[model samples]
Target: MENMHIVFWLLKDISWCMIWKPLGVAMIFPTLIISIVIAWRTRQFMSELCHNVAISVWISANSYWMISEFFHFDEHHIWGGITYKHLALIPFITGLLILMYFYLWWQPRNKEETEIIEA
Candidate 1:
């Protein structure tokens, strides 16, 4: 029946079409409220620094994923030395590397127990 075909098309096409709403909810909402709250509550420079840097990394990755997947602007390198298309990725990759360094190197320093461990 025509109605059955329409139902199937709607189910398959419409349901699978949109993911931006959920992504925005997950990415934007927490960064706005929770990350800032956690950073401010700590009142320590390292903790706040780590949280803010992590947020930047997250934003860059989210933008990269959204633009590449949804807009399809990431199909191929535009050409020339580091084309315009590749420029968008610089911050994303750099942010990730910085975040990694913070987590692996800097995070451990926060736990140094000068009273117990030093003795």
Candidate 2:
């Protein structure tokens, strides 16, 4: 009876540590990619809104991963302990910042019509 109880506890612990953690991590990539594609395909005001929202979501995910690493969330985990994991945030955040800067700053101003005076 004791052995059976131990086995059950062991499996439960392993399921939480091994199965759910990786599944959560795996969900981020495809979600980000699909969001980016959908944002790009959207038109006019919706396009800008979708793109910004997607970028924000991606940045938030990267920030969460960084926080997870700094607090040693992956210390004894099956995956996500490598140095490269933290480094991956650089390009993602950089690209998002650049895109935002261009969208907000570099876009051309719309011209307003003015009445022309005839000489």
**Which candidate leads in TM-score?**
1
lDDT of 1 by residue, 47-96 (tens): 45565656555555554545454555655567755544566677677767
Query: What is the C-alpha lDDT profile of model 2 across 1-119, one tens digit per residue?
Result: 33443343344345345555554444444545544554555534433544555454654455455446544663444446555455546656666775665456544232121111111
Clashing pairs in 2: none
What does candidate 2 score on TM?
0.39
Candidate 1 residues lying further than 4 Å off, grouped into runs, are 1-45, 80-89, 103-119
- Candidate 2 has its poorest 10 consecutive residues by lDDT at 110-119
Candidate 2's C-alpha lDDT?
0.48
* The best candidate in terms of lDDT: 1
Q: Model 1 — TM-score against the truth?
A: 0.43
Q: All models: lDDT?
A: 0.52, 0.48
Model 1 clash count equals 0
